[model samples]
Target chain A: MEYAYYPGCTLKQSAFPLDRQSRKVLRALGHGLTEIRDWNCCGATSASKLDDFLEVAMPARNIGIAESAGFEEMLIPCSACYSKTVVAKTRMNRDPRLKQEINSELAHQVRGEIRVSSILEPLFDAARSRELGQRVSRQLSGVVAACYYGCMLTRFPLDVDLRDDAENPGFMEAVLEAAGGTSLDWQEKTFCCGASATVYDRETALDLMGRIFSDALARGANCLVTLCPVCQMNMDAYQEAYCSRLGRSRRLPVLFITELVGLALGLGYKELYLDRHFVDPAPLLREMERQQETEAAS
Target chain B: MQEQTAFQVSGDAARELSAEIAGRSEQPIASCYQCRRCAAGCPVGEATGYLTPDRLIRMVLLGDRKMALNNDLVWRCLSCYTCGTRCPNGIHTSRVTETLKQMAREERLEPLHPKTDSFHRSFVKTSLFWGRMNEVGLMAAYQARVLWSCLKRRDFREMRSEISSQTRFGLSLFRLGRLHPGWTVSRGRRELGRLAAKSGRHSR
Candidate 1:
């Protein structure tokens, strides 16, 4: 299967491993990600603050580009992009006047026609069908991860029908488990990771991250498996800030669900950019793989 | 400034804010039953003093426009939609808070959290220009705005700390390839500019 892909700016610029690994993992599962031609930013939360029309217009414009490129739907991996575009698409669908106004202003076809989906949808389906299990070259037996959803994927009060439950989403774990990994049931799965609040107030963002780290660590989760680039970036980049606050050093590397899937498919650290994280995931994965080897030998 | 009088007095003025919020953001500020579910679930409840989702709505409902537009919640809202997820009525408080933030700006009230204002401005401006945000460009632009703000206020101490903290964070990001520096403008830049004009974008 091939879907029109929107890597978003973050995935291309900041969250590099997420985009690369997701594409590779999907390829291993016999799928393709075709980048949307000349896509703009989804405007994230920033545009929404400035003006309502700008908020919807930015994402709606990207959808228009995707639709014009002959795609019925586009796959966005970045949670922030996914949520912004999803909400805008939903609002545009319900408000004909607003849709027509934006369409005419931007010279888009203005019909809210194309569908939008997060990349997780297909991964979850592949896992459920046991295709993921069949394709897994290396079972992540000892890799225990707390499946984190952040906020964007959790609640869609609008008409965008998502696969997982709002409160306790299971798709991340299911995908990991299918790849022979252990999923730790955690309470802070849907907790906020402070989002763009990180830019203005690092303290608030880090504090929220601390709470998430505390919970996951207390639950014996070796690492956090997340789909949202913001959650992954916060937990990975600012981990030192988290540890220094506690007056002790501990590193709980946050891994993207896609990267984990790539690992299960026997992809290397270089391929996943595992060395690029602040809190290195290489040592942890090595240890887990050794454990798996030992269990198999015994 | 029909809405300005409501901020100063009470009665019909207070009621107008509620209606204005409804008309502007199209959020149902009136449907709040004060179940406190939103408050309990709010991720920033501990961080914010008295700006729980329910209380924020209450401020608008009571026509406390001054407080509503300039509160901690309005400036610091994560827009994570945790409140909306838990709300019985499905009222997304983030949208209400966003509407309040824009309201504060149009009134030219000094933002209570000036750094957040800087972030919003930098983010929108670059995103509008490049059609996407470059991590390095966004941060540099934000710091420049913040430092400029501090320079005007003659807050030398804040300028020093801001520089040091940002440098440290930037160094760390650079090491991780998180600060990958490149930009690609959308092909429809012309259309985007027209959209901004039609939407009344606050800045160029």
Candidate 2:
């Protein structure tokens, strides 16, 4: 499959690994990837608060670009971008008048036909087809992951074209399992990760992050895996502060699902940028390797 | 039935406020039936100083504009949409919060969470400025506004805290190569400027 990919703001810098490996892995799987020409920010949660038209128009602009570029599939790795764009398209499709008005202001016409999807869509498809498993060079035998959905992707199932159970999503689990990782069933799979609040409202962000981490830890999960940059960044970067605040020494690592898939697909730590995360996953991977060695000895 | 009243909506101004929010957010605020399912599922229910999803909806319904707009709930909403997914009435509290925040800003009311407001404003402004966000630009702009607000209030303690925390966290990010020194703008400036101006006019 060919895609016009939008890297958004974070993916270009802070979350570049997700962008880089998404390109490499998707290409390796025989998928064509093209970065959208001059795609702008989707306005995210901030846009909605700025102006209603902006919330729709900003993302609508990207959709229009993709549509005009004649791309059938537009893959956005960030959940915030994916959610806002999908919601904008859904609104435009539902309201013809709004569509026409937005179109008049749009530099490009939004035909509302280009299919937008999060990174999960392709990964899930490959996993389902066993194509991902076939290419898994290293089996993630001892890795246990908690697949996190982080609100935007699943919260508006009806409004957005997100195909999953918002309350109980398992696509990530299936995808990870194909890479030989074990996924645990946890209650906070669909919890909110306090997106931009991570910057402005540390109290709320930390509290939300703590709850998800506690739940995942309680379930005997080794790490929390998610596609949302906000989720990954906060949970991984803030775990130390949370641990210090709570006087708990145990740290929970948060990994981007793509990074784990990269590891399974024989990508190196530096290559996937795993070493940059605050809560290092190298120890966890080493522990997993030890467990596998013990089992082999037995 | 058991008591004098559990909740009630009366007064024209209050009802009008509810209607305005409903219309602006396009959410079915009228259908929110205090089911508390939203409260049951809200990730921030415990932390939001008694402003649960259902209670916020109740406040909106009752037209408590001050509380509705400047409350901890509005400032801290994650826009996670969990409440909307569970609302039998399909009322998205996230949308309601967004609308209330916008209204609060229009009223020129000082936001209870000045930092959040600063972050939001800087994020939007920088995104509009570059058509894509330059992380350095966003933080610099947001830091300036927040510091100015602190200075205006003469809250030196907060100013110190903000500076220390930002520097510590930001340095870590810079080391990890997340905080880039470079600025990258997109090629969609024409559309962004046109849309921003058009939206502002339409909003008015």
Task: Compute each candidate's TM-score over C-alphas.
Answer: 0.96, 0.95
lDDT per residue for candidate 1 within A49-94, as digits (tens), equals: 8888888888988888777778877888898899888988899999
Question: What are the interface RMSDs of all the models?
Answer: 1.7, 2.1
CAPRI rating of model 1: medium
Clashing pairs in 1: none
Q: TM-score winner among the candidates?
A: 1
Count of backbone clashes, every candidate in sequence: 0, 0
Residue A292 shift from truth in candidate 1, angstroms: 1.8
Q: Write the residue-wise lDDT of candidate 2 on A12-119 in tens digits.
A: 878887888888778878889888888898888888876888888889988988888899989988989988888898989989988998899777799998898988
- After TM-score superposition, the amount by which residue A133's alpha carbon in candidate 2 deviates from its true location, in angstroms, is 1.4
Model 1's TM-score against the true structure? 0.96
Best prediction by DockQ: 1
Chain B TM-score for all candidates, comma-separated = 0.90, 0.89
